[model samples]
Target: MAVGDPTVRTTPAVNETGEGTSTILQTRDLRKEFGGLTATDDVDLAVEESELRCLIGPNGAGKSTFLNLITGRLEPTAGSIYYDRFDITGLPSHERVDRGISMKFQVPSLYEEFTVRQNLRIPLQRAVESDVFEARTRELLDQFDLLTEIDEPATSLSHGQQQRLEIAMAMGLEPKLMLLDEPVAGLSVEETAEIADILQTIQAKEGVAFIVIEHDIDFVEMIADRVTVLDQGGIFTEGTIEEVTSNPDVKRIYLGEDD
Candidate 1:
């Protein structure tokens, strides 16, 4: 059995219909402190295979810190991280990616001067054989709806297109799990809705698990299979969207509502 607070089991690892599932990621007493300021406070999180989980919190709730720790961008002060039954606490960022963990940051990290094709080609070349590159790139472009701008410079695309392009590049790694930080930030309502649709399609078709951190409630409702709420660097509560949103305490803590 995986470690951590045994009380924090895979109850939330169920599908939308409430069928129990296995965990793909587990963190046991994961913690990080900067001097005396604790950033991640003994967080124990479990994400099931192909599940789309959302992590939400007010500013300073340590959402970014938790992600950094999981991605190996920062070392944890205490605790261990497990991915698919393997301890990955000490792996570097690149090694984590090599192990099928990919992250897309808040900002679109694209090659601004490179065409969409070129940007996608970069990672595809590294992940797949040259003989399969053309087929895989074509598939990614079609899946991301970026075929229209395949030859355009990444910077010339709209904010939403740029986001999609970046996601496509990350997908080039053929990851089993992906971490996305505020993917719809600054996008228009239509763009946001489109992004939500794209993510759902990808998750359903490819069975890739996603851990998304977003402040956009509507987008979260659209794509999340389960929701995890954080407060003061620790997991305050986790459940379905309805369960989390309807909790009086969650409203008070997450939305600053008066009791």
Candidate 2:
């Protein structure tokens, strides 16, 4: 049996449906610290295959730290991270991507000078034959609804459009699990809703799984299949959109209550 394998023994915690489900990413006693302060305190998060889990918290809630630990941006002071069936706690960022993991940061990270199509070609062209690369580029442009702006420089696109392009590039990696940090951070309501719609369509058609970190409640309600609430460095609670929203403690904490 592998160390900390769920297959060997059942976990005391059950899924949202109160049934055991296949998990794609899991952490045991995941922790990170800075000097005397603990950033992630014994966080145990489980994400099932194709599950859309959202992480939410006020500023300084450790949401970013938790993602960093999983993506290998930072090493944990103590814990183990499991992806699929392998132990990936010690893997680096690129290795994690090679293992079918990808991430989109809050800020847009693209080649602004390059056209949207060119940005995609930079990655796909390196892996596929010329014909395949061209086909993939066209497919991505259509899939992302960017055919009209295919040759336009990325900087010319609107904020929302830029966000979509970044996601499209990440999808080019054909990742199994995608981590997103505040994907709609600085967008208008319409823009945020558009992104949510695109995500739902992709999830239904392609079965892409995501672990998203966000502060926007409206955006969370639209895309979250399950919500994980973090407070002070640990997981406060997790549940469906309605469940988390209605929880008295969640309401109080989200409002910065003292009692």
TM-score on alpha carbons, each prediction: 0.90, 0.89
- Native-to-model Cα distance after best TM-score fit, residue 36 in candidate 2, in Å: 1.2
Model 2, range 60-123, lDDT digits (tens) per residue?
9899999899889999999888777777888888899887888888767899989998998876
lDDT score at residue 7, model 1, on the 0-100 scale = 62
Give the per-residue lDDT digits (tens) of candidate 1, residues 1-259. Answer: 5555476555321222133337788888999999999989999898888999999989999998999998999999999888865678899988888888988898668988899999999988768999998899989999889998889888899888888888888889989899999999999999999889988998999989999999999999999999999989899999999999999999988877866
Query: Worst ten-residue run, lDDT, model 1?
Result: 12-21
lDDT of 2 at 115: 97
What lDDT would each prediction earn against the true structure?
0.88, 0.85
Task: Give candidate 2 misplaced runs (Cα > 4 Å).
Answer: 1-21, 125-130, 256-259
**139: Cα error in model 2, Å:** 1.7
Clashes of each: 0, 0
